[model samples]
Target chain A: MRLSKKGAAKPDPKEGADRTKDVLGGTEIRIAYKMGYVLNFYREPSFRKIEMELGITRPEIVTLIFLNFREGVTASEICEFSGHLKANISRGIIALEKKKLLRRDVDKNDNRRQRLYLTPAGRALYAKYIPALRERERAMLSCLSASERKLFEGLLDKLAEHVPHWTALDEL
Target chain B: MRLSKKGAAKPDPKEGADRTKDVLGGTEIRIAYKMGYVLNFYREPSFRKIEMELGITRPEIVTLIFLNFREGVTASEICEFSGHLKANISRGIIALEKKKLLRRDVDKNDNRRQRLYLTPAGRALYAKYIPALRERERAMLSCLSASERKLFEGLLDKLAEHVPHWTALDEL
Candidate 1:
């Protein structure tokens, strides 16, 4: 019989120390930490696989998503928009450009700044990936109901209201 | 004037693109990811702080917590209990012993296995850190209501259940 590619059999939790099993709500800490842990796993394969398959990480997807809504966006604007550090955005822009997905042009009005626009290829790639990415996103969001997702998004906006440096994302 | 030492600035979302800001829904992903991110940021500092203060890391704390409940834990057992990989637990034991926080005794009945126990210092340190940690945990948890935290933790656990492998925490 063939085992699923996901992994081999699950390790029995019973064999470990019994006393530690329920210690200090051990179960909850494990649960709370799971989403972050799973994100790492999901990202590694999905980003690499999808990026190789389509050539973009989710962050890059965010970049394109925002850029589509507003063209002539600056690197600083992207840093602020994506909440990604400048170095990461800089590197991402470099990667996207290397793939000929986009291009950067010096702002005619501001020499100190550069404006970003998607190349024709970028537009095509974005069109290709968004649907697939949205599918995956929908699947992940399926864990939450529509009303729950909206309320959760609202609460997230509240908690997230605290991050001000994102305004200076250009300095990122 | 000097900026705050920790730079715990809250992010402002209105200024940036709203695309990725609430993409994951709820502050759950942002808060937790930020916690993990902050933990990673202070990882070196946190590790050194614990070493100088209590001789432990976040992962080691989990180990000590588990060991406190049950002494004489084997490497494989610790790995299983902590959801860490074998390599991580191995390294963790080596580090704990180096700090004199824990000791591994060769199982008399089983030559191939060893049992781990925390030193007196480990217990003392745990007692000291627990209160401070509990406070920070409460602050984070306060972002959600009692019921939301319950549902959130459940979602996180379900997420972790899907991940195949994590860091080699067991060996560490």
Candidate 2:
């Protein structure tokens, strides 16, 4: 595991002093790090109540959210849309089906594929759980004024739409 | 599995039209969804090469990044800083130790606690892999102008610092 340190500089005292402060502040990775930090707040705590009350995992909640938005989508589509692993989504779909919250139908146009839809139970579960998500989001964004929120949303839209341009590591 | 349709309104044609569009554009969950969308690009592809070259998982790379920033920290500290699970951070620490890239020292003040530091090999590995991360971040943020980037950063800082207020499920 050792690599040649031929060109590696000695750790400077000044740099060490700077490193002792925060995680990513004033660092090259701050942007991504900060974004991830905020996302973490959304990931675990935001969904904790739903996960406990409904006996569903984060992946299952994600599946419900996606199906709530668009019915008759395949697992791969959910994976693509949610950025979740195919295996996780597959497992969630199976669990939701077993829980009687979701159902699958053979795609009429593609016999090899199955499309997912929420059962009435699933829809009701989503309805019951969505307000919490909305409230959490509202609280998270409460720090911003209405105009600042609009500006932030626009910036986010720009970055989200730009994902394809920079997502490939090989391209970098 | 069927839910009572007592108060459930009929699915409107306009709402279905909106649903057929892109994921999370005009929805209540758009902020979180957009942030996650941008984050997925960073989470998977940004670290793909490093993962391949170093034979380290995402959690392990995250471990290295955190250690690089501040050494002599515990796994729990890393979890708090990185928003990763303790089990994953513990696993990464074990793997890094096995690879001889990291070492732990028992705290003199508290023998039950251990502090982690990067080995020379680990430092070299971090040095080599960090440029790619910097470049990826640069590319990701290149879309924004300098002023807009500043604004976005401020918003992120506000949200990240506000995490404590909204992070608890019970608070919501």
Candidate 3:
């Protein structure tokens, strides 16, 4: 019921404001509000950068990511693993095939199903992007102490686990 | 350079199977990506709830939040603080005035400048929503240990402050 003084939640902005985040000077902070606000800021450039530089869109990369992690999966498996739209996954499969990053092979058991794999090229692309992706992650988390980072990441999973689904958010 | 075993990052899916969050039971994880994804899930319900039950749109509620945090600020200031568009701020301001949630008064020293404040009704509305909001936040973050929750909230601010602006994300 009490609104704390502004900026009481964290250290001085002068210390942390190196460049990426648009942190308001005054902060009557709410956990969910601030987190969602920040996610909006961070999402655009990463998604756009991957597209602009690699000529690969999010669904494409996401499909590749699933393939990289778990090969021998079919398009529907990718859909189940990633929850991407069926159409988007189909389009992504086609785009990745065109890029030669992935190859779609017909299932011997069922000709109707196409098993997907990260081609050597696609695997290379994933490896190449790892550094950049890791760096971005590092920068986003650089503010946390080593101990804080561990706890924060651990808690993130816990909170994420707490929600059975998005609809659960409305009830909460 | 290392991709850990599956489910190393987030909890196992069986633990948090929900309709909204498409929590991947995989090895790769990124702070910003996962957060943004969850935010997208949480955002729809809260926003839709406000709109359906209270008739306040997202932009309108967001504007009120900023005003609630930092009163006496101009519309342009809210835009700068939240990175919201000037047009959206103007529209929100008009909506709030119509709803009697806020009042605008011209600055005496600068006749051309108008300052905004929450009316008594607005403050009451804010108070009314506080419990529901706190409840939602608690549920979203309930998985954390008490100590972890403390560090998590603190780190959220630190990381948020890390970005001076969204463009800095491109550099990262």
Between prediction 2 and prediction 3, which has the larger DockQ? 3
Candidate 3 docking category? acceptable
Worst 10 residues of 2 chain B by lDDT: B1-10
For each candidate, what's the DockQ? Answer: 0.17, 0.27, 0.28
State every prediction's TM-score relative to the real structure.
0.55, 0.79, 0.63
CA lDDT of every candidate: 0.53, 0.74, 0.64
Please write out the lDDT profile of model 1 over residues B78-136, one tens digit for every residue: 55445555677778778888888888888887788887888998778677765544443
| Model 2, span B63-110: residue lDDT tens | 888788678878766775577777888899999999999999988877
> Scoring model 2 with DockQ, what do you get?
0.27
RMSD of 2: 10.4
Instruction: Write the candidate numbers in order of decreasing TM-score.
Output: 2, 3, 1
Across A45-131, the per-residue lDDT of candidate 2 in tens digits comes to 667768888789988998888888778778866665577778898899999999999999987877877889899999999899899
The TM-score of chain B in candidate 1 is 0.60
Error of 2 at B165 (Å): 2.4
lDDT of 3 by residue, B76-152 (tens): 65654455667878898899999999999997877876889999898877666556556666666666678777777
Tens digit per residue, CA lDDT, model 1, A79-107: 54345666777788888888888889998
